[model samples]
Target: MKTLTKEMQAAITPDMALDLLKQGNARFVNNLKINRNLLQQANETSDGQHPFAVILSCIDSRTSAELIFDQGLGDIFSVRVAGNIINEDILGSMEFGCKVAGSKIIVVLGHTKCGAIKGACDHVEMGNLTALLTKIRPAVDEELTITENRNSSNPEFVEKVSEINVKRTVRSIVERSPILRDMIKAGEIQIVGGIHDITTGVVQFHEVESL
Candidate 1:
């Protein structure tokens, strides 16, 4: 109910951070949200923001990190893009969030029925979005289980690609950012990936492994 502080953030271990998000999502699914005054939280965090986690998620309206995680203001850093792909700028933001800003964890969150993943699956092209969706193309191509229907129309294929995208993004973050890679290696921070079920309001973490 109170704004996160540096001490609190520092106290969180990688496993603890994962647990916190799990509990938050449990609260979300059950509609048993914590009672907090957002205006008060905003006022308390005005001086500084000590977000506990940095969430790389989609720009999809249904996958808002704050709402899905049931976090309040100054609770988490939300870095959003169409496909949750990592670019130079996004890697810089992650560096700042964990290396400089004292966040404990980084979560690459993808969701079921994600438009971005579907676009990538079907090779949807637009002006600038063409390049953006291209980032997710590897995931679509990596889904070998669903060989027959490898397009967005196949719900299973779409979901598989979405999961692959989350894991790929997680790997890309550590590969692209030396600072973040060092932090993960030194046990100062942790990176994980998850898939959000839009219909169920649940997030399932993919796997736990060191980068």
Candidate 2:
């Protein structure tokens, strides 16, 4: 596959953009790859980028959205942060990726065994990161199934909080950004959430909430 051009990106529907990521993840899980010259794609996208989807994921080294989605240069916009939490900066980036640049879909991609989620689960505090972890505390609170072992020591609690955080970020995006919310209502774009299994390399996508 070649790098996406302005027209190509424009032609892709929100569903098609999502399907592309799903197919790419399938390839990733099977250790498959598309034969594309990275250098050539670099030159192709030098003038401008027309990415079809914008993915907000964690800053985990193991969870690079480009690699996991098997997308080449200019295929997608990646906005990464700890916990994949929603904030003003992230919201602005998504707005630019879609309303300004014409991306078709937005994905809040979280992963298993996320350190930030763990910190939130444990209520870790140590400077600026304390504030960041606070953003994830709501998700940790929403994970009600784990009563006894609510801290990071329990893997199940951490993972549950991870999943909840992704879904929350997905909704928060729509709730926070009026530009994106209007775009969603006008059928111009869409938002969804998913969890990336680190060991398996398979991303289990969640439902796109109608909110």
Candidate 3:
């Protein structure tokens, strides 16, 4: 596969961009990686980059978006943070990725057994991490189904909070950034959420929710 050019990126619809990720993840799960020359891609994208998607995922070592999505150089813009939490800076980055950089889709990717979600579940605090984990507390609050073990020790609760955090981050991206929101309304971009199964290496994308 060749690197995406300006016209190629422009030709891709929001839905098509999402399909590309789905196909990539399928390849990753099955170990059917497409052959591509990384050096050639590096040179091809040297002057400019026309990535089709912007993925915001956790900073976990196991959940590298590019590797899990099986994308080559310049295929996507990756924005990672613990818990995949949304903040002013993340919002601005998404706006730049879509409105300025012409990316077709924005993905908030959470993962099962995420450390950040686990920390939020237990209310663990330590310096700056405390503030960062606080951003995910709302997701824990939103999860009302788990009444018994509402802590990270329970695998079920951790996964539930992780999904909720991804959805919340997706909502925040659309609602917080007018540039991205306007672009979504104009049919230029789509924002979606997903969860990566650490054990299985499968990314389950949620239904697209643009604007």
RMSD of each: 0.9, 0.8, 0.8
Clashes in model 1: which pairs?
A: none
Q: Which pairs of residues have clashing backbones in candidate 3?
A: none
TM-score for each candidate, following the candidate numbering: 0.97, 0.98, 0.98
Candidate 1, position 66, lDDT: 92
Question: In candidate 2, what are the lDDT values of residues 1-211, reduced to their tens digit?
Answer: 8789999988999999999999999999898989899999999999999999999999999999999999999998999999999899889999999998999999999999999999999889999999999999999989888799899899998998998899889888888888999999988998999999999999999987565
Candidate 3 off by > 4 Å: none
User: Taking the tens digit of each residue's C-alpha lDDT, what string does model 1 give over 55-162?
Assistant: 999998999999989999998999999888999999998899998889989999999899999999989999999999999999988989887978878999998899
